[model samples]
Target: MRVLELLEEIEEIVDTAAGFPLTGKIMVDSQELLEIVREIRAELPDEIQQAQWIKNERERIIAEARTQYEAVIEDAQKQADALVENNDITVKAKLRADELMRVTENTAKQLKIGTYDYLDSILYSFQGKMEHLSSIYFGEMFTSIEKAFDDINSALAANRDELKDMAYRTQMDADDIPAPSAESEEEDQ
Candidate 1:
């Protein structure tokens, strides 16, 4: 489902929730919200994949650039070899070949730099959205932790090991976040 649909689902839940007497809080249906959150998680990977495809395309373009560069070099060699019998013709052929090689190399470099810049911009845009998502996701996790703290003192005394296990699992889940690159680490700071 689209993101707007997910937002709409959340809105619907909030709108239909049972209100508290004095607190400005509503009792939400956990199972329904969990299902929608899962759906949102499922959709998130698709967006990530779309961004990943730009990286893939950049590699492809680099490959094609290399191929064209090689082809140019081969053609230049063949032309120079065919005119080897005449010194002047051979000289001209070699000069033309060198010029073509230089031009192709410069073109390839520009293409690669441009591709990298384009991919970087795209990833940065996605990063902002992903950060927002992480904030929301962990915000929910923090709320759960707060609630668990509220009533779990006696229960925790009884099942301390179970609480430890739950905290461990939550930590593991949170640690599943992708690590940033050196540049992104700087950006984050």
Candidate 2:
């Protein structure tokens, strides 16, 4: 009876020893899982920080580009204002030139009219005197000469009877006509 009991106890001890290797394997697997979790925890914060840095750089670049664009727009507006000012100045100069030309033309026209008026006054003042002088020099002399010519033509055109009548009328005339001569009367006696 004691030998049987000792054999049974030795068999139980051998079974427990075989199960120790499985427990050791399980502990090793648990330690490997813990190490993997530690590595993930170590690397995650660095990746997140890098992502945040990239986002901040992109925002900064966008702000800088916007500032440059606004500056360019402001410069263009200034140039346009300068152009408008120059145009206004040019237009004013042109209008002034036109006004000056008009004034000059009007002055010239007035001067011409004044000169013509002066000339007309001189001519009108002298016209009547010139015509009167011409008429006095040649008027009554031309009429007397024409009458003498007409008398000579009538005497030449008379017949003998008309001449005898004219001589008898001359012998009888006193104050209304003039006698030829007293010597001619004695010769007739």
User: lDDT of all the models against the reference?
Assistant: 0.73, 0.49
Tens-digit lDDT string for candidate 2 (1-189): 232233333333323432223223111132433444355456456645655665565555556555654555455445445555577855665565455555545654554455456545644544554355336523433343344345445545665668899888877775566556899889999
- Cα misplacement distance, residue 39 of candidate 1 (Å): 1.9
Clash pairs detected, candidate 2: none
lDDT of 1 at 151: 39
- Top candidate (lDDT): 1
Off by over 4 Å in 2: 1-86, 151-189
**Candidate 2, which ten residues in sequence have the lowest lDDT sum?**
19-28
**lDDT of model 2 at position 173:** 78
Q: How accurate is candidate 2 locally (lDDT)?
A: 0.49
Model 1 lDDT vs. the true structure? 0.73
